[model samples]
Target: MKKLWNIGIAAATVCLLSLLNACSLKEKNVAVLSLDKSFTTRSGFEGLLNGCYNDLYFLYGKEDFVAPTELGTDLWANVGTAGAGFTLYDHRLVTTDGNLKVIWGSAYSTINLCNTVLYYGKEVKGYTSQAELNAKLAEAYFLRAFSNFILVEEFGGVVLRTTSSTVEGVDNAPKRSSEKDFYDLIISDLKFAVQHLPVNQGLRGRVSKKAAYGLLAKVYLQRTRLGEAQEYARLALETAEELINHQTQYGATLYTSDNTRSGFGKLWAGENNKTNTEFLFIQAVEHANGYNPEFWNRGRTRQFFLPDLGGRGGEWGAREGSPLYGRSNSRRFKPSRYLLTQCFEPSATTADTRFAESFTYKFYANANKEITNALATTYKKDPSVVGYVIKGTSAKATASVNFYTQTIEEQTNMANDAGLAVFTPNWTISTTDKAKMPMMVSDPSDLFDPATNKYKDPAAFPDEVNLTNVHPALKKFSAPLYAQSNQYWMGDFSIIRLGDIYLVAAEAALLYNGDKSKAAGFINTIRKRAALVSREAEQVIAPTVVDIDFILKERARELAGEHMRWMDLKRTGKLTKAYLMQTNPISGELFDASRHTVRPIPQSFLDAISNADEFGTNGY
Candidate 1:
């Protein structure tokens, strides 16, 4: 027998339908329960209401998990097996497709759950905490809008469900809502949430009024509602700037330079929630169910480092090898070359400290651990710095120079330890392999095998890990300085940051005030932070007015790989054009632009519906 699940319509739908009829029996039941529910009670109605909160995990954690954002835009590099399919636009994914479906399905699932809660919530009588109940309800509204934002952006129009469709004879098939209407609902919900939610949250992961306003600004920006965008952006700036300016302990800050074991590179090292203020929404990594970093490291029995396939190590390291080596089964996300390059002036020689801070390829190696020297009853105190040399065949060759000034035995040991000889072109010491450097510590350091190693005097030792690889490891989300491999619990992912908002405001001022200098100032501000020579020095950059097209591209360069790429492209009607790299794997060719912009709606949805016309835009 075919069974029909009575999933309720959205809260909006209930309100709309309520006007047509005074109060249906089902509606009365829900309304009565809404007014009677209690936060502390374990009643059936309260449990269902609590279920609405569960929708948040699905909304923030799984639905838009870092993959889509990372791959959609060019901010992140796709080095692992998981990225190959998504980055290239192949839907043959076991995990990602499931993630997409969860995003799609979870939105509607929560809508129904919210509908039930709101309906029953209105009628419930568990009193004394009206403020708490209202706050919770407001959160529910914000989540529903947030979910819809993803749906409308990814798949376009979606069935605007508002109330539970539990009644046996109630029509379950709802028509697709227009995009404008969808945004309208989203804005309305966020506005209401801002009014109701507290500015501060007791828990780290919970959303606040500031977050609501911040998201509202984003929605307005996407809709091209400049005035509204400005208003929301200003509100967000006011709310968050204070917290940031105070330099409160709540927010996370990167250490540009530090020598402690828990230094700049190991930010994501521990289970401690150190930087929560800046993180608006984050996926929590459970104590036992944390991410696996070992799966991506090199020379491990479990997984050989990058450029290697399966058990056989490859020529170049795979994209994620540096950060994940010697770690657990999980891996860290890496920003892309396009992202790094975009922040700089088109000229390679451009100087920008802000851009420089994004990455550093210089360091002083600790002599004790990296290598050893034998001299008069004492070894050299530290390992010498390995300077970076760019001596590839051509400027674009992207190759590193191998400076070999070592004895045959020293070179041979390194090669043997890495399962490859020192003469091999791609054999290089990685950030994780710093401990393997005999010169990074005392002369007779723990890093070297004394029997086969030379540095004998244990007196002198080196102090920092120097840069050796052409591609330096990222410091952005590194595990904190002292954490062991398995400590990567959830850290906050900033969907919106103060830096980006400044850019947005600058663009808005240029558009609204015709002040090109304002926009240039905004771009320059970010550039200055990146340690790059300011665009101000370039005559071409100063006169560059904030054209919509320029702003869009700038957003791509600045925010690529952060998960906002596809939506921005879609909003600007450039998704198809930007996907110039959407190519086929087997054939190794680009996909037709017309067929690549939007994915076909799930086949199952079309097949289940009796009339395809009723569903919505079929990309027809």
Candidate 2:
């Protein structure tokens, strides 16, 4: 089945083989002649549908897919480095940006593949049973809707091509469809998927009936129709409730605090087992073909969140026993100060396991390496240094500290004694005035003293704290295999999870029915898990009134680095006000809401099509 799926994906990449039969003989006999074939069997149709999944995996796994959604949002801030993501974060996006081009091309290309499957499935024979045919058709419908949803969210009112582009000149230049039309099509397709898709597909990556309902809930919520949104939200809630009730039957369950070692931390720590109840859909990545660079099977998510200076050779390098013992090639995005502090209640930072689990504040030196006094002076300027060694003699030596852990402090003191200059980026302890410093001591008694306590107001912390080399590292997607090699790590990317569904339920209840109590009930489920508190103790951590802002903040805290922020902000009409005006450090004031809500249609796309000039770009 895997071999057939691989062959199908390769064949689909060449041309829509099934659709080539409909093209003119002159055109079909040219380059597409060898590949011209139709999927006559149910297995063949299933294989073609698998090809669509492959394309989606490739599209979603790329850094570009993450950047457009995550970079410019309220939760994430750029690290003052120039890259493809800079334009997205700063709202300086031009139509020619390669990221924009890739997203557009990949999404439409996948859509075309889906169209081929759906169009040709009507004539296909050799179905062993009717259930098999319906399943294949349902998968195709789901992929088509998913691809169209991606297009609509990023580039608004995009050309909605429902049929295959087999006849080159006829269907090549499609005009932009209405946003209403696009939504209607998505809703229609998803409804069919929900009706036909089974309860379980027996695979983690494959879409199930629950996934379809979940998507419909999202789709309805995103559209302008409030009544429909409420209806679908109700449907989604019922669907989620069904899944939650029968966990074993569907092979799904929530990652509860009591059973899991890390509680909320277990979700992202690469512990995606077969019985993982949280994951609704995951992009199953394999280390097949020995890390093929061209294939998107290897995950690069960990690289985006990692600080560039903390990889292998840097001062605060990744070491063997630490949580951050992984390869991090780039620090493209960092958590905004608002997210690290303001998003969570001050008490939640301590009580909530997510705060500690999500980020790494301490770094260790894995090897014995020297740092010159000049480089130390440039990176960290401290006058106390007098002929420092600046080398780690042992792996246990704490190289750097973002938080004020006692082990780190003792290590720093040792470095100072040994003339090994210690570098602290955003914090410092004054030996003379102990009253001012925010210290994190191991002893609980030290927390009571104002002199040795955590920083009260992280928002008031200096802007320099957000720099690439010194910011708090996101440790959720850390890949240990990439520690020594340049090749990116192979890890599964989760599309939707039970935690996300809980939040979606909360949002839907709040927005659609204005049922704050029910929304709170849903929100409490996740909050309780986050705080490691029981259902009865949830009131302490859960919000009393479920508002849009609170839900958005909760989403940020729960779903950061998962690539869902921009849509959350945009869907709730909070993008311009919350993200563009208030949150973004670089382009906060410059973001024009009307112009920047959706991306501009790529210039190359407009130039290729003759009717595109008449259709115009996405408000470019």
Candidate 3:
């Protein structure tokens, strides 16, 4: 009977049916199929738990979550172009934004699923083993807590739906709980998760004891109770220390920078796959098996960070096989000047492998490509008409002429030149010339000068570049092979990693005792992996002052584009001072701290509630 339930028919079937019906079926199914029907077995509960996990794909995997978390932070600058949820960065979001509605609804929907799993799993009889049952329940608790945490953080005092909203009418009109109550539930749920989750789940994506500890540490740090925050931080540090001390026990180790590859470099290279030890928790996105809808199961985060390269396809898109190269549709957001220059500090462009590994500033000539005289006129007339680079071997190449600058006469002269090979009328290029020409280069200064061990012309690089088209393309989320029609990238997105745990512990220690040395030690561990020299030998090492600003900068260098900046700034109350006030040539804004800390509860949500007046908007 347990084996029968392991196939996930009980949960998957019900979930599919409910999805079709556009409403939850948990209560109805519970009544229709009792515990005796093998629907309440340990395996049955596991299926329901899987459903809760699946819901995350819908919640965090969307643009809404990414927009609120990434854009308008210290790291990213909105390019003032229309993309999914652009208003988030501009701080022009309203109560009726589509993405907000999805975020709000999807979070609660996932929470409901988690509640259902927890509610009925206790009543199940035939557990194959008590350990299995406990593990499944532990996962449910973690998912429930995580969903609620996202809710409370985003909306402040949101409705706390603990039990399954299976009884639809009963839950339909629930009131918002106090912020303290929300944190209490999150803490309790995480404590339960830590108690029952195994140290090793045999899969990197699954929740583990270490992951629970890491999340708990973050939760406590976020909560307003300073004493409790310090206490939990200590607990989190102990667990992190233990994990670091006994790496083999948990199959975890930091990526070390070698001559050829940096630890941060290895991560985007798909080296952080399912078995990679550094990952604590990941949203597992596999290539669709042709049966499931790819949209529901695949990850497209890579699309959001991409630069608008629609016209410059062959000339400037991702490299053939490099991890930093990928096809992207909407180049929604670009790296903020602050993040590019300050976070990695005096020499990010050269010293920090993380900076180099995370961004693509150059695109090589793909093939013997050219634009014709006729095409050049058209391209000149339309600024959007851009060329692309074909994947090819090219070395010692002169930088390609800026298409934006070329006159039609110059293009015609090149086209008529008998000595030149005309690949197309707008431009002429020999196969020989292709090997000697760069397709596109955004920032020529990004090239490192080994003699000085720093990027050339570091001071000359302008803080304000053309934000609309030219900027560093984020390579961290690149998924070349998994791209869908060269529009979106499909890759597994990591939610937590051991590197982050170290930072968490560092912050916790700093807050707990104000001991800079202790905090610096943890931060240095991350710095060492980045190939930074020891602090004693180098003046530009991890901050001696272990303050929030220092820690925030370090986080930016290490964790940018991982959807953490907004939360980090908000949690530390630095959103306005660090991000809003900082002027940039692109999409900088004057954020209203009082009203912008939390987003407005979607207008649709308020209108749907019975007591709509009581459920007032947040910080509107």
Candidate 2 lDDT over 1-620, as tens digits, reads 25535655554653432221223323442343333344555566566667777665555556777778776777665644534343343445777777777777767767777887886688778887877788878887887898788888898887877776643323434667787789889989988897899888755467887677667766766774324556666665665555555655655666767633445866655444333567776666554343232453355555566554443235433332232333455556666556665674434225567766777554444343444455334434343432333344232222222111112212333343332222222222343332211111111111112332222232443431222344456656553322212234555557777787778877877766788887888887787777554432743444465798888888987888776788887887777744554554444545667777788778777665556677676666
Model 3, range 1-620, lDDT digits (tens) per residue? 22222343345444322211233232355542453345476566566666666556665445667777776566665544443233343445678877677777667766766777777876877777877788878987898888888888777887888765452423435587888899889989988898899887753357888778767867777773334656666665666676667666756677776666666677666435535567767776553331222343345555566654445443332233222234444456666556766675435235557777776544433334544434434323232223322333332212132111211112222222211211211112243433333333333223322243222334544442221344566666553434333333445667878888788778877877777888888888787677534321242355567797889888888898887777787777676744454523232344556667777788876765566677778756
Deviating ranges (above 4 Å) for candidate 2? 1-5, 14-37, 81-91, 167-170, 202-204, 224-249, 273-275, 288-297, 310-313, 316-329, 345-349, 369-468, 479-487, 533-543, 577-579
State each candidate's clash count: 91, 2, 14
Two-way TM-score contest, 1 vs 2, winner:
2
TM-score of 1: 0.59
Q: Model 1 segments beyond 4 Å from truth?
A: 1-50, 53-67, 70-96, 127-132, 165-172, 225-273, 284-337, 344-477, 481-489, 520-558, 578-596, 604-617
lDDT of 3 at 597: 73
Candidate 1 CA-lDDT value: 0.42
Each model's lDDT comes to 0.42, 0.59, 0.58
Model 2 is weakest, by summed lDDT over 10 consecutive residues, at 439-448
Cα deviation of 100, candidate 2, in Å: 1.4
What is the Å distance of residue 159 in model 1 from its true position? 1.0
Residue-level lDDT for 256 in candidate 3: 71
